[model samples]
Target: MTLPWETLTGEPRTVELYLTTPAGLALSRSMFNSAVWKPAIRATGIPDDRHNGMHVLRHTYASVLLDAGESIKALSAYLGHADPGFTLRTYTHLLPASEDRTRRAIDKALSEDQAGDDVPPSLDGLDTA
Candidate 1:
């Protein structure tokens, strides 16, 4: 993805592989450190002394996906986690609600089946004296 832009040198040029605004410009470490991170942290209302950063966004993304029933293996791959076990260990706290939902789904299915079993089989075109 190349876009026309002016470099800091004031030379007109095109940049590639950039996603953030000022479209063609890629994020520089200095830009992140000085411009982006502090403002985002302030906006989030997290104390500056506490832990908060892009990693928090990553964890939140994983947690939301897990709560929505996305597979752990898939999430691990998405997160670039080397092993599914690490992903599971990291996010195990998010799984219990999913397990409860699974249990409820299974119980509903079994109850529906039991209700069906209570119905007599249809007798069509039969004669009774």
Candidate 2:
């Protein structure tokens, strides 16, 4: 029931982690890239570059969280980064663009507010003035 991992020597081992071959060996990057990643991305007609590789999946995950207003600290933990600052440095560019935030802020500011609403502030507010 655990994620399978294989060492460079093709030794199967269990970690407190995340893939594996049908033989229960954790799928290696090379194996996955050749057997799965390459074919899938190629089918999608992407340029077949590293940017569209498996690494992009991590960025896509981070981007989703950031777009959803997840904090850097929270995203850092999810990304298993040692520090939130590293997460910021690595993924800050993926954050919602300032103009998008500005548009949302203005829309929100211009909207009528209902009294006695207990709505909590969204993290999107952090990205804007």
Candidate 3:
């Protein structure tokens, strides 16, 4: 779907097309390579020898989704991967520090239990000791 800011005359742009020049002409691969991508890389001051491509953007998107608590299966589907296992294998390192967060949560719960008055309702009948 065309975003409100993407149209000049307020008419929705076609969904099938992604890249277009300022004049509304479809941006060709050659135009993107020479006119857009190269200039962006040069502006960043990254060495020409370093890895640079549209795939880097895809990786960033996957990492952001994983860090935001999106399930691996859902990310896999969004990324068009055939298997969730592939997504897990590719993005395991990018996942958030859930182990640290879990530890902190448990510590808080135990401290609240010790305080007596703040014990969670779910742990009320359990032997917290």
Candidate 4:
């Protein structure tokens, strides 16, 4: 469940926490107040007043997934959502672009398909005049 640091960053660092330092006793709080989080918050233009750890990252991840055409059901599963409806409601705004893209793709596919070209018009015998 742990990611290999070497894969993302070549910097050598240990993941283990020893209780010797104040940070080691409460890792979440320490990390939330750390320099890394502070800089990341500034860089991302996110308010630093949020103290709920890196939950903004979770929101961003969900938004990104939804933006990438991932279905709400799939995103719910990936995020361990308690209910698919919750995921849908929470990420509704993030889905419109993806939905539009999908709609366009389907329309494009249908337009390019030659299979329907041979079908005679159903109203051919009906004259509007």
Candidate 5:
């Protein structure tokens, strides 16, 4: 579909807008690179390379959300992945270590039976003396 555009030399042109702004406005490729993306990448102090493009941002997006404890099913839908299993496979390394999950699970289960600051009840079969 043809979209409106302006040339660097002030000529009006017809073109397709590729990247869009967060506010939903269509941005031509040049406009997006000059006005938005280039500045953001420069701010990060990393030299711009052909390999460091929008897909890098997408990967970082997934990494940050996974680190924040977002569920695979929810992240999958947010990322428009067809299957949650794919999301898990792609981002499993970003999840917290199993030890963290185990600790949280024990803490949560015990806290529900007490005021959270109380000492956990000792398992009857374990002797700690």
Candidate 6:
């Protein structure tokens, strides 16, 4: 699966990240050095802080997606999680408070069915002793 960052780049190059250098096509951990990361961050007008970095952006994306009511299963697939359980455990707060609503709906349907079963028929002055 393609990474979200690759999609956001909006450019097709033979190399994935930096592209065409002695250091190969793909990005590496060393590519995130203070010189490379800090300047790019500064250019973006985001503050230079210890906690505010690329990883923080990833976490923000995950949290936002969860809060937006996306399904845990979908999120797990998106995040490449081995199991959906991790997604559920991480974002349990996003679950809907609909237990009461579900129960009420079921009860209402059952009540309607019971009422229909008791329907009475009208007779036009026809009686037999």
**What is the Cα-based TM-score of model 3?**
0.61
- Which lDDT values do the candidates have, in the order given? 0.72, 0.79, 0.79, 0.69, 0.74, 0.66
Error of 5 at 1 (Å): 12
| 1-129: candidate 5 lDDT, tens digit per residue | 343444346646665546677765776666777787878888998687756766667778898888888888999998989899998998887886678888998887656567554656667412343
- For candidate 5, list the clashing residue pairs, or say none: none
TM-score of 6: 0.46
User: What's the count of clashing pairs in each model shown?
Assistant: 0, 2, 0, 0, 0, 0
Provide the lDDT at 89 for model 2.
96
Q: Tell me how far candidate 6 lies from the true structure as C-alpha RMSD in angstroms.
A: 12.0
lDDT of candidate 3 over 1-129, digit per residue (tens): 454443366756546566888887778877887788878888998754436765677799999998888999999999989899999999998998888989998887677668875554574533644
* Candidate 1 accuracy as TM-score: 0.60
- Model 6: per-residue Cα lDDT at residue 90: 74
Better of 1 and 5 by TM-score: 1
Q: After superposition, how far is residue 88 of candidate 5 from its true place, in Å?
A: 1.5
By lDDT, the better pick of 1 and 5 is 5
Q: Model 3 off-target regions past 4 Å?
A: 1-18, 21-35, 117-120, 123-129
- Which of candidates 1 and 3 reaches a greater lDDT? 3
**Clashing pairs in model 3, backbone N/Cα/C closer than 3 A:** none
Summarize candidate 2's per-residue lDDT along 1-61 as a digit string, tens digits. 4333543566466563257787877778889998999999999898899888888888999
lDDT of candidate 1 over 59-83, digit per residue (tens): 8899899878899999999988889
Per-residue lDDT over 1-129 for candidate 4, one digit per residue giving the tens place of the 0 to 100 score = 234464575555656554323644535656555756677777887677775346667888998887777888999999988799999988897775556767997786556454475745544322322
